[model samples]
Target: MKITVRQEKAIDFEDITLLNDIAFGQEHEGLLVERLRKKTPFVKALSRVAVFENSIVGHILFYPVKIVNELTEYESLALAPMSVIPELQNMEIGSQLVKDGLETAKNLGFKSVIVLGHKDFYPRFGFSPAVNWKIKAPFEVPDEVFMAIELLPGGLMAVSGTVLYPIEFNM
Candidate 1:
C-alpha cells in the first residue's frame, strides 16, 4: 500500500474527526481536535494527515505554545492527540505524519516542540525529557512522559519553563 503524508485541508475535517474517534475509541480526543481547531493558537499549516488509497488513515496536530518562567515566555509548539486507524497502528502511518508535521513546523520557523506522549515512542523522534531542560508541565504528569525537541540548535538551551497548553487542551 502506498502512503502519502501532507498538510490537512479544510475538506478533511470530518474524516479526521472520524479517524481520531475510531483510533481512540472515545469522543474526548476527537472533541479536543475539534475545539482546538477553533482556538487562536491553532496552526493550520502544522496539522497533517496520512492518506492511503485516497483515504485519510492518520492525523497529527501541533499547537503554538509558550514556555513561561518568572522572567519571560518563549515561543514553541506542542504535539497533541496524534492518532492512526487501529488496523494500521504498526505500519508507521503515525510516524510519517509526525515526521512530516515536525519538518513543516521547523520550516515555518518554530523553535521547539513539546509533547505529552509515550516515553519510548517519542524518544525515537529525538525528543528528550523536558525536565532535563528545567521545563515543567502545567499539570502534574510523569516527568518521563513530558518531552521536548529543539528544532533549531540551542533552541531549548536558553529557554526552560512551564508549558502553557491552549485552553482547549485543558477543557
Candidate 2:
C-alpha cells in the first residue's frame, strides 16, 4: 500500500471533513476545520492530506496562533485535530502527514509549531514539552501532552508566553 502526501485542495474538502469525523468519532473537528478555513490565519500550504489508493485517508491542519506576553506576541502554528482513518491508524499515514506538514510549514516561513497530542507519538518527530521553553497552553493540560517543535534553529528560544488560539477553536 502506497501513500502520497500533499497540500490539501478545495476538491479534497469533503473527503477531509469526512475523514476527520470518522477518525475522531465526532463532528467537532470536522466543523472546526470548516470554520478555520474561512479565517485569515488558515495556511493553505500547511493543511495536508494523506492519499491512499486515490482516496484521502488522513488529514492534518496547522493554523496560525500567537504566544503573547505584555512585551510581545510571537507568531506560530498550532497542529490540531490530525486524523487518520481508524482502519489505517497504525500504518504511518498520520506520520507522513505530520512530517510533510511540518516541512511545508517551515518552507512557508513558519518558525515553530505546537500541538496538544499524544506524548509518545509526537516526540519521535523531535517535539518536546512546551514548558521547557516557558510556553503555556491556553487551557489546562498535562505537560507532556502539550508539545512544541522548532522548524528552524532557536525558533522558540526567545518566545515565552501563553498560546492564544483562534476564536473558532472554541466554537
Candidate 3:
C-alpha cells in the first residue's frame, strides 16, 4: 500500500467532498470543513488525502481555535470532524492523518490542540480532558469528550475558561 500526505488545493475540492460523503454518509462534516475554509482563511490545510492508485479516499482538517479569558488570548487548534472512506476505516488512514496533523501543528509552533471526539481514540495521541487545562467548550460536553494535547511546556498554562471557535464554526 503506497500512501502520501500533501496540502490540499482548490482542484481537490470536489474529490475531497466526494470522499467525505463516502466516509461519513453525505455532507455532514463536509459542511463544517467548507464553512471553516470559507470563514477561517488562515486555517492550515495540513489536511491530507490517502491516494490508493488515483482515487482520493480520505481527508482531515486542522483549524485555529482559541482560549479566551478576560485577560488572555491563547492561540490553539481544533481537530474537528475527521473522516475516512468506510472501506478505508480499518486501514490506518485516519490514524495517519491525525498523526500528520499533530506533527505538523507541533512543527508550526502551535502550543495546544483540542478535539471534541471519541475519548477512546484520541488518548492514543496523548489527549487529556481540556479541564486539565481549565478550558471548556462553549457547549457542555463530557469531560473526556473535550480533549487536548499540549505540544509545549506551559502551552496551556494559566489558560482557563471558554474555548471559542471561529465564528464560522456556527457552534
Candidate 4:
C-alpha cells in the first residue's frame, strides 16, 4: 500500500471538511477546525494533512499560543482537535501528524507546544502536564490532560501563569 502526506491546498477545503466530519462527527471538533482556519493565518501548512490512497485520512492543527510570564515571554504553538477517520483510528495516523507538527514547531523557533487531550494518549510524544511547568489551559480540564512540550532547552523555564490560546480557539 502506498500512502502520501501533503500540505492541504485551497481546493482541499471540502475534503478537509469531509475528513473532519467522519472523524469527529458534525459537532465541536468540526466547528473548531472551521473557526481556526477562519481566524488564524498561521495554520502551519505542514501540519494539516495526512493522505492515504489519495485521501485525507488524518488531520491535525497547530496555532499560535502564548505563555505570559513576568520574567520571560515567547511565542508558542497549540495542538487541538486532531482527528483520524473512524476506520483509521488506532492506526497511528494521529501520532504521525503530531510528531510532524511538533518537529515543524521546533524548527520554527517555537518555544513550546500545548495540547488539551487525553492523559494516556499524548505523553508518548513528550507531552507533560502543563501544570508541571506552571502553565494552564483556559478551560477546566484534568491537569495531566493539558500537556506541553518544550521544543527547546529550558524553553518552559519560568513559564508560569495562564496559557492563552488565540481567541479563535474558543476555549
Candidate 5:
C-alpha cells in the first residue's frame, strides 16, 4: 500500500489517539501522547502521521529530553510510543514515520535522539546502544534496547550521562 507521511495537524488528534490505542491495544500510550502534546518540548513539526487511503494508519512523535553530564545538560530528542495499526505491522508505515521524524529532528538542529525501544528495530535507523557514547537510560534497562543516534557528525561522541525524560512519559 502507498503511504504518505506528513506533520500532524490539530484535526488529526482524535485519529492519532485512536491509532495509538488500536496499535498498542491499550490506552496508556494514547494517554501519554495527549499529555505530551500539552507540555513544553512538544515539537509539532516532528510529530507525524502516516496516511493511507485518506486515513491515518500510523503515528510518530519526537519530543525534547535532556542528557545531563555534571553541570551541563545537553538537549536531544526522544522517540517514543510510535505506533501503526496492528493489522498493518511491518507494512513499512512505521519505518517511514521513523525516517521522516528523524529527518525533521535533524533539520531542526537537534544534536541527537534517544529511544528505549526494540533492539532489533531501531538499529536500521542508525541507532546503537547508548553505552557506546557513555549515555545511559534514566532507569535500568537492557543496554541494547536503550539506544542513541547522533544527528550531527560526532554529536554524541563526547557526551556521557543519564537521560532525563519528561515526567509525562512515566504516566
Candidate 6:
C-alpha cells in the first residue's frame, strides 16, 4: 500500500485525534496533541499525518522543547505520541511519518530531536540514547527508551542538560 505523508491540515484534526485515540487505546495522547497546538512552541509544519487511500492512518508530532542548565538553554524538538491505527501497524506508516517529520524539522532549522520510544525501532533512523550527550528527561525513564538524533553534525555537542517539556506534556 502506498502511504502519503504530509503536514496536517485544519480539517484533519478530528481524524488525527481519533487515530491517536485508537492507536494508543486512550484519549490522553489525543488531548495532548490538541493542547500542544495551542501553545507557543507548537510547530505546525512538524505535526504530520500519513494518508492511505485518502484516510489518515498515522500521525506524528514534534514540538519545541528546551535543554537547559544554569548557563544556557538549547532548543530541540521532542517527538512524542506517534501513532498508527492498529490495523496498519508494522506497515511502515509510522516509519514514514517519522522519516518525513524529521526531514521537515531539519529543513526548518531544528538541530536535534528527542524521543522516548522503542530502542530497537528508533535506532534505524539514527536515534541513540540521549544519555550519550548527557541529556536527561524531566522524569525518570530507562536510558535506552529515551533517545536522541542529531539532524546536523555536532547538533547536540554543545548541549547537555535536562529536557523541559511544555506544561501540556505534563497533563
**Which lDDT value does model 1 have at 115?**
97
Give the alpha carbon lDDT tens digit for every residue of 20-138 in model 2: 89998999999999999988968888788898889999999999999999899999999998999999999888888889888999999889999999999999999999999999998
Q: Model 3, range 74-154, lDDT digits (tens) per residue?
A: 888888767777876888888888888888888888888999999999999889999988899999799989999988878
- lDDT of every predicted structure (CA atoms): 0.90, 0.92, 0.79, 0.78, 0.91, 0.93
Could you tell me every candidate's TM-score relative to the true structure?
0.97, 0.98, 0.91, 0.89, 0.97, 0.98
How far off is residue 25 in model 1, in Å? 1.0
What number of backbone clashes does candidate 5 have, counting pairs of residues 3 or more apart or in separate chains? 0
**Best-to-worst ranking by lDDT:** 6, 2, 5, 1, 3, 4
Per-model RMSD to reference: 0.9, 0.8, 1.7, 2.0, 0.8, 0.7
Q: What lDDT is reached at residue 76 by model 1? A: 93
lDDT string, candidate 1, 33-130, tens digits: 89999888788888899899999999999999899999999999999889999999998888888888889999999989999999999999899999
- lDDT for position 143 in model 5: 93
Q: What residue runs in model 3 are displaced by over 4 Å at the alpha carbon?
A: none
Q: Give per-residue CA lDDT, model 5, range 1-171, as digits (tens).
A: 899999999999999999899988889898999999998878899889999999999999998999998868888889988999988988888899999998889999998999999999999999999999899988889999999999989888678899998898887
Q: Predict model 4's lDDT versus the native.
A: 0.78
TM-score comparison, 1 vs 2, better candidate = 2
User: What digit string (tens of lDDT, one per residue) describes model 4 on residues 8-57?
Assistant: 78777777777777787776666667677777556647457888877788
Candidate 6 per-residue C-alpha lDDT over 75-132 given as tens digits, one digit per residue, 9 for 90 to 100: 9999998999999999888888899998999999999999999999999999999999
Question: What count of clashes does model 1 give?
Answer: 0
Deviation from native of the Cα of residue 43 in model 3, angstroms: 2.6
Candidate 4 runs further than 4 Å off: 69-73
Show the lowest summed lDDT stretch of 10 residues, model 2.
41-50
Q: Pairing residues by index, what is the TM-score of model 3?
A: 0.91
